[model samples]
Target: MAHHIWRRSLAVAAGTAALTVGAATAASAHHCYKVDWNPNAYANHMSGNTAWMPLSSMGAMIISAPAPDGAGLPQCASYASVAVDHWMAETGATSEPLIHSRATVGSGAAYQGKTVKPFAYLQDSDYAILEEGLGMAIDQCMADQGA
Candidate 1:
């Protein structure tokens, strides 16, 4: 009976150790910043030279290259624009109408001929509008892509 109890205690200790290690690993893997406006709850991985995120089933936002300053807001905005453009192209067929409407009326109005600054954009109400429009477009894009 003593031998069985010792074996059970050893097993419990090993299990506790494994659980601690697993929790640490998961915590470390969450190296992204969450976006409040994004309906998909996308998180921006701002580590290294490039900053990007995934948009649910729609697709991923991949920066072509890392910004010079690494974590500058302006650079992040620039990269975001590029990534959005790429997403637009990939989903053009299904998203053209929505994108065009936005360009003519809604969130796109704020973006016309304007350089995007991440901080300023976030502060603007137009940011939420743009996010909504973008979410719609992404949904259509995903449907078109058979995803």
Candidate 2:
């Protein structure tokens, strides 16, 4: 399951017994210039924010890097947030069952459409690592199918 793989990856990155993975540490000091980035395979992956949806739909989820905390302000490079509000609505988890979850982003607000969001903050130096991680997972999944 994607959950198991993601959790294991998080655990490996965090170096913690708790499996609470977020983002890698930034190596630089000054804020790096903004970059237009996203995972190429989002259309085929899933996020806990979208647990409401079947694994089949996980890859269809598209999301942006974490924006700064304030409006129009993007969060630091190490912070990318995801939104599951759309996925939740699509899955009929409209009540407290999904609202109380931190895995889900937005309140069915902000972004418009269907998707699962898992907000992750990445180090400024490695803003795109998440995509690579996803790619690796996808490759592994594909390899599994081939086997």
Candidate 3:
């Protein structure tokens, strides 16, 4: 079940990264960015005060869910922040991460219109590494940003 995978991934992430997995209602620092589901594989850009992360629609919903307290923001913003940081560092990008300027021009666009796949249906163990990696990445990003 998706809940099982989510719990497992969270556990693995916490253990490996040694970071507390807090509620979706994160701090102000995590609110620095917003996510936009798009056709891009992975892309990020800063627009004014908000960092925008563009990913597949499914990916966006997974990370944008509200906290248990029903707050507007989610802790998964950390994941997006860390991912953007790594992409920037890996590509030596001072401003952008991907060459494509359009957010909805890839094959992923076909499925972008579908209703967000619920977390209960997102039960794929194969992607556990992604969750774990994002967890560690967030920790690293936090340290790098002095947050």
RMSD to the hidden true structure, all candidates: 18.6, 16.5, 12.5
Q: Clashes in each model (backbone N, CA, C under 3 Å)? A: 0, 20, 0
Off by over 4 Å in 3: 1-61, 66-73, 98-103, 106-133, 138-147
Q: Which candidate has the highest TM-score of all?
A: 3
Question: Model 2, which residues run further than 4 Å from truth?
Answer: 1-60, 63-126
Candidate 1 residue 127 C-alpha distance from true site, Å: 36
Write model 3 residue lDDT over 17-110, tens digit each, in one string.
3222221222212212222325342332323222333322222233444432221124444455454445445544354322122222232432
Q: How would you encode candidate 1's per-residue C-alpha lDDT over 47-115 as one tens digit per residue?
A: 222233232111121111122211112212222332344434554422211111011122343457654
In candidate 3, where is summed lDDT lowest over 10 consecutive residues? 118-127
Candidate 2 lDDT, tens digit per residue, 1-147? 786666545422322111112222211211121112244323222244433332212211211122221111111111121122322334343321211122434425424653334322123323243334333333343344432
What TM-score against the true fold does each predicted structure earn? 0.21, 0.21, 0.30
Clashing pairs in 1: none
Ranking by lDDT: 3, 1, 2
